[model samples]
Target chain A: MAHTGKILVTGSGIDLTLLRPLEEAGNSIVARPKLLSAAELKAELRDAVAYLHGGEEYASGDALSTAESLKVVAFMGIGYESFVDVDAAKERGLRVTWTPARRPDAVAVFTLGQIIYANLGIRNRLDERYPPQWSAAVPMPSELSAQRVGIVGLGSIGSRLAGLLLTIGCEVSYYSRTRKLAETTLDLTYRTLPDLAAWSDILVVLLPENPSTVNIIDTSVFARMKEGSILINTARAALVEPVALGNALRDGTIAVAAIDGHYRDESVNAALMREFGPRLLWTAHVAAHTRQSMAAMVDQAVRSVLRALDNAPDENMAVGQ
Target chain B: MAHTGKILVTGSGIDLTLLRPLEEAGNSIVARPKLLSAAELKAELRDAVAYLHGGEEYASGDALSTAESLKVVAFMGIGYESFVDVDAAKERGLRVTWTPARRPDAVAVFTLGQIIYANLGIRNRLDERYPPQWSAAVPMPSELSAQRVGIVGLGSIGSRLAGLLLTIGCEVSYYSRTRKLAETTLDLTYRTLPDLAAWSDILVVLLPENPSTVNIIDTSVFARMKEGSILINTARAALVEPVALGNALRDGTIAVAAIDGHYRDESVNAALMREFGPRLLWTAHVAAHTRQSMAAMVDQAVRSVLRALDNAPDENMAVGQ
Candidate 1:
């Protein structure tokens, strides 16, 4: 059983609550502290059947390619692109799967929370606490109900976000890939991206990053935007051209913006700050991170491993279920 | 008419939006640039007919005692204790009036927002953006439905906070000065402060500061609190005794706490940080500062000023309005 070489769980920040079943079933589990560089990773994966990619494994591409004996790579999230080399892994008879990183409730709550915090100026209040007995600097942020919110993508997160925004009396509209069916929970209107930009007092980027969406919010989209609008990004960074965003912020094209998902490094955030200015309220890529979601993600990961061990079929796989 | 004598609004951050009406009413309003000290304020108020207190004006009794012909000491807010000698002003035929600050909508929004941020670990995501990358932090925050909340000092802000919390499925309980009448909007159980502390997973303090309430949450209260319970103070700082709070957090008797109304200076916050570990989230007194509330506050201020002009007899008169 020790020589079975059944599974490998790579990365940190993973809840091992679900992975216990496979370990209990007498399948050999190879656990690294977290994802190391390619050399260190190659040393760890001498005999592992299925590969698990957690948060850190997605940082770079080198360690991913070295897991030679890996048959399946089941990502703990919908973002398999970060860790899975689609082209390289396809050539190696490797099947990649993902748990749709959809925590609609969590994201909806967070969106509403940030909406109030941004509108109500929680950051300014926090900063006032760090001062020289000064209280005049805090900006009393405005109300979201009085704000016109335009979302670029009306997919799952965006649609749910639209509902939350509506509950707070925000005027909501969105741009989607295809026309939506009919009337829905939110008072939503479909508009061209540019038109949406022009109308919105706050433009939140929630579009998925694909060939169509890559830098979709470039100069033209920003050029049509209202002067004092705020840009909030919980989506992929590349969805908006960073250069255009910086220029927009600098030139009074936007008043102030708050973001929850951007680069996970200081240098990157610093560069973003240099360009976009420190006015960007930042959080790491944790838009949908509720404990419920993480626990659900681990359950899915364990199922994938158990399926592979039992040689049974698993559906709902992102790339190849 | 020009010699009506200048009504000196000496406090900085004295609602510009509110003063617009006074300016338009032909009352020449000269706005101060900053929160002035007692000496600077005396110089500024040499010829002032009425002096508005923005923050604490004097540390001692004589500051207000010696000022002759300072007829009205009008306040922009309810915290007149910070800036005025109420009894002394009464003796001097100096009328001091204040706008009662209450914003259920704003406090409801902020309390819920901070609660979500705290129990859900919003700062973790904020921390994830920097040196400790998002992936390195595991067990992402939990959802609100899973949290157990307790409210202390269930006054206006706390009561409204409880209503909001109940609407969102929080296991809400409260401890007020007296028991509240039954209301289904908040299925709130009235608990003794000790019972509330013991049963609550998160304790939200919304008490006012006074001799009776000061250090009310000292070692005994912290000891009564459940392990890993969080403390939130949008009310007053003296409600919590920091030494006990530090000990609780350090020994894991309590987990973390957030205070938005305690520190008057960064040095005080810094001193707290030095005394207590950084498990505390310190912010300036800005819980009731949405734009809507600011506008409302200023509106009330204008009304008070106008009521004096209207020559209407009214109740709750501070400075013989």
Candidate 2:
């Protein structure tokens, strides 16, 4: 109990500056930036004071069930679906904590920018930009002022995104199991999932990925949306049925799609490129890579690990809350 | 004037609707869409009603100066820079009419969309999406409400783009020689070019590609721009000095640039993309490619041709004006 060991940040691509307090506390720090898959972490499970996980897919059940010396597991972002094996961690006397994902103002701005550009065909134009030299820029665009936006699962991030849209003059509406106390200036209207689908010119998926939320935007949702309406899935790819989204895009039911999650393969982007023709605007899963947010993310993650060491639970992120 | 002869519509990718009305006007339309390259026209200039010139580079003087029965040389879009040996056309008694470009509402929407979206970085996100991925968008996205947009030319399209930005709550400013008397609530400040550049977050160019406009966005203007500002050129690539633009991007004097011109090849886009790296966004010269705008462009060209044939002199667009 009196032995001093290093805090090893596993899998999460957290920045090194976050371990400042721990370093100052005179503890050694080991950080593996890449998100580690289950198949690769059998050996390193035993020698860590704390570990931070990344993304929505990583293994913790088998690793946690046996790693007797593992004291804490800290999830930096809200999504702990990948790293949290609560029952297993709890049974093994290990503590878990997660810092709920905040909207990260920069990400919201980026989203609004994407909606304006994609709807107006800005990204598509670049895809078609002439090779070697471009003489002119042609924008095939629609107006945000003219469209209705439906945001699903209006949690912290979604609500923040909604506020940004309202600021930009978009008619913002939301569909959530619960509502929060928001300013009326936001002009946010709450609707059922089905009604939200029918009313939106653009539907944004901002809720976390889970079993119940899988295929939330199925064929029926596509059919309900106004023809040629857009779908922006920054939430999770599973929220949108890929086949349904594809069918909608091909038939022009959904005119264009901009996704930040759910497909990172070249084939997917290439298929989308071919199927949507110019209607699809693809960005390679980089919706959240702002300089500010990254720095913040790394700082938040490292802080969470230190709090775990002090045995003063991370107040912001209740362990397994 | 009495003889009914087959009319040849010369120009590759010439909008068919422009010539479609010519057929409806009781003329036999012999359409040959060509790129004005050496192989096609010189080989068969005899098989020509009018020789329609495209918006790219123009034909040689001898090609047009020596034509015997090329009675009508119709220049497709606004700038007659593409065609018209005016002295020769007058000497031959052949009519040369330039369809004055009307900054169509559709084109304006496209321009606004690109301006907003380029700043957002949508294309990179959507194409790059991976299921269960995390990344930040832009670190310090310039807020639209907080921005001062400077329009270099207060001509038809420039003015319209300003209006659209105004509708989205952008503080619009301009540097036009003449005063724009548009009804608006926008704080449209009429400033000098250097002042406008200094004061604005985004600068849009919608000037004619002329000697005066060539290299207008040079070092002086770029230096005047606020650090980390976005520059948009939907008018002409020549407006930007490629080297200056490249240097600004490298030095971060201009944070990001979205250009729609300079499409001899990918040099402009590539240079910006390389020097700027994840900051610059360029498109193949396609800022006015909406369904409505394309139809409007074709309709305008055809109507212009018809009006010239009917002897209705549009003195505003005639040679002197």
Candidate 3:
């Protein structure tokens, strides 16, 4: 029946229609399109059953301290690495859930698209101002089948991306925290981070953002990469140092860099623009924002919230399932 | 033991080293990197046994008449369609050879890249001018898995393109010259040109250039296309009319157009720039110019020329074989 408890929906890009199920289940909804600070959320918190989260809004111990009536907090995105304080939620005996490995298809597709873009030299080949005249202006793009692609993280998105690249005849290797059991169907090799960088013509970053990954791809990593190699980052900005990336692009340490995620700080974008200009293919964190993937994620998040309110067991909810 | 006849190499983007087999086979080489006119080629045609062609160099009845010692004319690129005077060469008893369907891999890869580009809305997603504020400046791109794609002319490149699209979860249908016997492995449907246009969210052109295909994608075809559907062309310039494309893009009959081939006449480029500008993803005719593909083509062309000089049968010299 009517669950009378209020649901605080906080996210910038989630479809509101997804919350209609919660409303139909008889819960009142307060949707916040922009991320509010912990103190601001605390001030507005009242008789809330759950908080459906999106964006970079923090749920720190101090914030959770004020969430007196909060039963659950669920994220509509895959990563819950740096964005949320899971420890704090656990301390308060509050359940925290996130759509882990959600939208891998969208992210993997975006990564594959960037790989195609760089390998085909689409940016240089398609510039209208300077028409490519074959050998003179447009040298042939490197074939995908001939290039070695190295991915930093062998997570869900990375594994899916590897499968896609393998379909296109790309040789795939990855560096993850642990080695996956050999799949006879996949011609994938596991390598050390430095070895992967040295061996690859194109290095892709898809690591989750955490203390260990922050500034992981620094000058040292860039120095190890092959000369005129390309770097593509669709992961978090914390994984790459802005100044080092800019320097690498300028000094030709890397031929081109396609970056999708950033720190949500304008200065980072401005710095990349000032240094790389058209050389840097930048997208404002919309890689996982495809119509189908986004809808699936929002549905997952909403269902998780509803399940939590119904006092369903924790085993019942997981990301994208 | 040696074929001492000279070979005239003409093309803008050919890798010269591919002709080494001809030299090894005892043929002298005279390469003119620029496209030579009928009169200009006539002046240089003395004692030439083969014409290694590239670009739009015409070997007319008059030109072939002047090529007194010319036994064969071979092209380093695919499509001997409108560029070569096949009838004139046949009448003159001159063997006409081209690397037809030679670089289908390259073209297919490029088409896949363009498909990813249009489906992901990469141009708008990556535009730095309008800072995306999530669902405002940049909405979620259409999913590759969710879009219905239509291909015109399911020839070599188109069929290969179809396979790649299928790999990435796109529903593919095509209007080819003839139906490929139902392939259970491939989830492709055969459709009439008009029906395909109406049914698609994206239209791709990879038709070979011929009298029937010239200006085939006119205003009527665009009129039939879905309102927000995208169009991609990496085939021949003659397949789609430029003015109709511009009008379609302007009137919202199409959402985006990623074109890689066009009439060498700069007028088409100028007009598209004037009308669509950023909306049109324009690339010079470099879709089939991957290093591996180019090398394969030039090798085939030179070998064809050498074989013709050696009095080999014409049956073995057909293109795309």
Top candidate on DockQ is: 3
A244 in model 2: Cα distance from truth in Å? 5.0
Candidate 2 on B1-321: residue-level lDDT in tens? 322345656543345655667777776776654244544554444444455555454445556654555556666556565345566566667667665665455456556666766565444445443332333434434445446788888777777677667655578889876777742444588989999999988888877765567788899998888777888888767778888888887777776677765544446656566656566566655555444454556666566556555656553244421
Specify the CAPRI tier of model 1: acceptable
Task: Write out the backbone clash pairs for model 3.
Answer: none
Candidates in order have lDDT scores of 0.65, 0.64, 0.77
Per-candidate total of colliding backbone pairs: 2, 52, 0
TM-score winner, 1 or 2 = 1
Q: Each model's TM-score?
A: 0.83, 0.70, 0.89
Which lDDT value does model 2 have at B10?
A: 57
Q: Name the top TM-score candidate.
A: 3
Which docking band does candidate 3 fall into?
acceptable
Residue range B85-164, candidate 3, lDDT tens digits: 77777777777787764757788888887888887778766744322456654566778877899999876778778887
Task: Pick the winner on lDDT between candidates 1 and 2.
Answer: 1
Model 2 / residue B243 / CA error / Å: 5.9
lDDT of 3: 0.77
Per lDDT, what order, best first? Answer: 3, 1, 2
Is model 2 an incorrect, acceptable, medium or high docking prediction? Answer: incorrect
Where does the lowest 10-residue lDDT sum fall in candidate 3 chain A?
Answer: A312-321
